[model samples]
Target: MSAALRPFDVAAIRAEFPILQQQLEGKPLVYLDNAATTQKPMAVIQAITDYYSQCNANVHRGAHQLADEATRRFELSRDKVASFIQAYDRCEVIWTSGTTEAINIVANGIAQRLKPGDEVLVTEMEHHANLVTWQQACLRSGASLKIVPIHDNGALDTEAFAALLSANTRLVALPHVSNALGTVNPIQDLTRLAKAHGALVLIDGAQGIAHGGVNVREIGCDFYAFSGHKVFGPTGVGVLWGKAEVLQDWPVWQTGGEMIAQVTYHSATWGELPNRLEAGTPNIAGVIGLAAAIDWLTQFDVSAIQAHERALLAYATTLATDFEGIQLVGTAADKIGVFSFVLQGSHPADVGFLLDKQGIAIRTGSHCAQPLMQRLGLPGTARASFSVYNTLEEVDALFRALKKTQRMLA
Candidate 1:
């Protein structure tokens, strides 16, 4: 919590986003599906429009005036991203399509070092994107994947994570925050344990970064990945931050026009860290929009935002606690602003549909985390995730809607 900020005013903050003012079915929208993707503000939208309309040109290749302006804006975005995460160097950052692609980049690029008997350790709580890529990587390189178990409360069993690290462990990958459960892992300690076994660490910040700040050098993880859409930015752009040295050593996963240094008919050299990773014209508008989103987000007081979310989460939990047959899926000590729960007799999809009729938006089903759903011994749960834009009034509306839903089923 920063000292300069005062207590958050939800009403004041809500005014900035015009989309939230709209109605569905003659009712005001109550958007509770933030974990799926946050709604973008006018700032982010305007940033994209401004870039294409004014400074429309290619970057890094042209010597002309418009090209130089485009290049400057693009590089400014890079610096903004680097500062947002507190990266050691701006060059450590590389852009990708989204979290899935970022994770895949590491999985595929690191394949050159993996061989039979080498292990890539993960956990049971991982999203399929994280799980499947490593599964394929292990299959290709003859490396094996290991899963660390979670406690019944949905928190990572850190003791179990420590116990799983062996001499053959080459990589340990985990999420900073679980998209399904909202569990915030102790990544610092996890990284330390992995480092003790001479294993590199990759922390998936897809669900974590948008809600809170991240310091890459402080966390000391080898790699961190997150998506733009999750953070009020455009959908197509994502970030993969690595220690510059580690990124330099990883084999190039993609190759094309922009990534090349010299070309013969036979062999060619590649560009530097980011340029080598980015192989084409890139998502120009998406990147610019993301930069605008980051800039807009940075303007608010983070402490106030955190306090508001915590209060709203507490309120939501109180309402949910009274439902007799309902079961809260994840009760981890450290959770973000997400709630996943199931009524004993109700299917998640049915609840989702009913809520939509009330002009309430929430996500239901596996949430790209089918394994986690199976672990909880359920088909799925309806999840309501909050952001800075959500209000106590919206939370009350959700509770009223849920009570209505429970009665209709009864």
Candidate 2:
């Protein structure tokens, strides 16, 4: 935690988000759908509004005063993003639509280099964004895709993961945290092992970015990708952070204006590291709002926020354990934010529907992880993910609603 910040206050934090004050079906809102997307705070909303009201001009191409201001803010936000993840160089932080597009950018380059007998390693807990991207990359390149097994407790099998890294492995893609199960992987050690084998590692950071401090240098991964909407920012914006050396020569994901340096009727040349990958007019307001979101989030102490989240998860776990007919899924010791479970003799969708009637917002079904659901031998689970703004009272409300849901289903 930063020395300047005081004790964590859930009430003070909750007041910053206007959306949380509303009601559904005459019940106060208890939002637990954070794994899907987070609600924006007033700081982020004001930043977007200020951008459109003051400087509504294209970046880097306009010569007018509004253009200059717009370009300055746009580039400054890029610097803010570079600092947020502790990235070594600003050029390595390429803007993308979200984690999905970021992963595809890397996959596009790797697929061109892969050949038969090469392997790409991934885990059984991947969101479809990371899993299907590599799957298709391997299919297109004739490389074998190897799946690392997870234990019944939802933790990654470290022994199997190390064994799978062989001379044939060219890339290792894994999620920093499992979106479906809320299982946090040991990414630092995993990245070290992958580096030892000379294979590139990409961490899908959609779930991990909002939980705690993430230092790219300390993790030693070549690439990390995350979405802004998952961290109190605007939608349609994300960041893909890569090693400067690795990204300098990465094949461009798209080709258009802003990405080109020189062009002829027959051929053209690409721009530098960041712009080379980011083609056309970018998501201007989204990027500015994302930068504001991170700035607001960092004012609080990271350790304090993490401790509060851990407490929420611990209390929720205790309540779930004693609740009859409720079976908790993803009981990994290291997880913090998500609580996924199923009701005995009831479908997950039915549980979610009943909970919604009480103004408890949660996610149901595969969570973009059908393979993980199949691995656990279930249809799907109802997931309730916590954020820093959520209160202990909200967690209790979720359980109370679940009790009501159970009785109604019976």
Candidate 3:
């Protein structure tokens, strides 16, 4: 089907992922752990295989035929990432290990310029990746780290966010979507607010990248970071899209390999925007596979996929509402299909264990937002995150299994 013409067919979509067509024990596998890492489709697998089997070589430094092919595909992947996020320029796309490394690059660079009294604002909803990096940066620079509050329902407190901003607020780091709560923050509005306060904004786009169309220029953030694996691409590869003007003269994050322009025993000049930040050999196959994943994703109508996911969330929510012995976590008005809850009188880990007996895979525990869990007064939560390929039948199966789990626990 044409990119514009293909309608979302869940059966067809599920068929593309070989892992989904499996049985764990005697029960059919119902994978609901998408928020951790998406299953790779054949397209991504084939792309990686083609790269290794046909043209595997070091990029950008050789005159051989294999090197030329490798470099072409590797750089084209950069263009794909730039176009995917609507970046200002392809050079603005810097490859990193993943979102953690991407944010580290920014945090480390900013640490060089931060002053003692400078303040950094981050939300309570941040994954530790966004939180810890900035926290350590503040520690290194003697800057103060301020946290923006979230409501009991897990929605970001916009009013409190505004109140926290000040002339001394040097940066505002926020998650585009809360990994634990599935709360989708109003990034564009929040970005505008930070810009008015003259603070640079960085969006941790790990969860938001695949859910909706992302336009970095439209959002007006100084930097946006996302992982390839979160969007059904390869792990160990990610993109850091920053405004060219902001990144062009920024302090270099790494100092070796192609990032250097001139070398001496004592002094070396750094290269331009992207290469200046990307040091050493990159995950070439992972990048190519990520591009292929992007190509595969764009083939389906994004709106249809979104609609399907919404229906799944709504149906699951309805079932959760009527289902006894369950208390929902992170009931934000705006959220993705991450159904997090705890059965009454049972630990989240226990619920997850019982669900797994029925072949339902869910993520249990704090989900890397320990502070958010503390704020919400939960030891942890059982999370069933969704994706475009998930089906309503699978959701039904989840609840059915949950009922059995609750009974077993009771």
Candidate 4:
């Protein structure tokens, strides 16, 4: 189906998340820490409950009715994920513990192929999940880890990225959206440039998938990785989508049951495409819940969700600009619902604590992008990230709490 935007019903949407009805510290809870992880909708929670209640069994191993049912549901989630990302083939989708493990799987496989002095490129805006794995891979192979700089405006320096790419560049790891800055990188353009230099590209879609759906074929990247928890799904479940041709030759990273074709005393043969990568007992219930989340999300037009989030971010940004001693950290022309900022003469942790007293939940500190923090020359920033269920009223409440926090600190 073609993607289109529809009018959003915020109240109805908010009702789907049960956690939103609660209170914190005797005040109504105002959740704005979505960039860390989104609250699960009832649909997702119920799916998990149903799995544990009705069909809890080890998948793909038994002939019992419950095992058959469990296996069926587990594989069904893979099909749903493949469709969600518009992957070329369903077999291209490999399940992992989350984005961190997903990236590690690729890095482990790529480690076998890297050579001394080979260049692995990454942007400065990457989260630790994407950056650390590549650093380890380069270190193991005696390869060089090259960095692409970000502009002062929180956008990637595309010109610097272009200049950095060369025949020696083996892989380019980047994020679809900056988790800390909320800057949306031009993935398609970046992928094309990397591919032109004969480098494979891996996009960390942990933030991007929640904002809107992704189409891997259109982006032209070799691999895409995302976490389920970031998109209103259960934690400990994520996807790694790769081109079949490329994955076919990649060496297996993990070993054990469900990933071997033949076992012997001395050596064993690995299974095909996805099975080769996914080893041992999987997160069956989490995968099922993730599918439910994706199913619920598809009921609404993704473009509509994106627009709503953008509106919330713009509203928050405007309000922050008017506040005294407030400095917005990332002001990229393109961004999502993440508002990272710092107040003069106040520590980020103190601000977070003060906000929490009023039942406002926001993230503080480096947000796992310490390298990006070092580049920006700040200890940390207080972050308020929005989602589809967030409202203008919540944004207003956030500012009110911030005002109170500023006064207390002053």
Per-residue CA lDDT of model 2 for 145-244, tens digit only, reads 9999999999999999999999999999999999999999999999999999999999999999998699999999999999999999999999999999
Cα lDDT over the full model 3? 0.91
CA-lDDT, candidates in order: 0.88, 0.94, 0.91, 0.93
Angstrom error of the Cα, residue 224, model 4: value is 0.4
Could you give the candidate ranking by lDDT, starting with the highest?
A: 2, 4, 3, 1
In terms of TM-score, how similar is model 3 to the real structure? 0.98
- Return the lDDT, model 3, position 362: 95
Clashes of each: 0, 0, 0, 0
TM per candidate: 0.97, 0.99, 0.98, 0.98
Give the distance in Å from residue 396's predicted Cα in candidate 4 to where it truly belongs. 0.5
**Model 3 agreement with the true structure over 1-410: per-residue lDDT tens digits:** 35565787888989999999999868889999988999999999999999999999999998999999999999999998899889989999999999999999999889999989999999998899999999999999999999999999889999999999999999999999888888989999999999999999999999998785889999999999999999989999998899999999988887789899999999999988789988899899999999999888877776776777778888999998889888888888888868888888999999999889899999999999999999989999999999988898999999999888888888
Clashes of 1: 0
User: Per-residue lDDT of 146-187 in model 1, one digit per residue for the tens?
Assistant: 999999989999998999999999999999988898898999
Question: Residue 41 of candidate 1: its Cα lDDT?
Answer: 86
Off by over 4 Å in 1: 1-7
Model 3 bad stretches (over 4 Å):
1-3
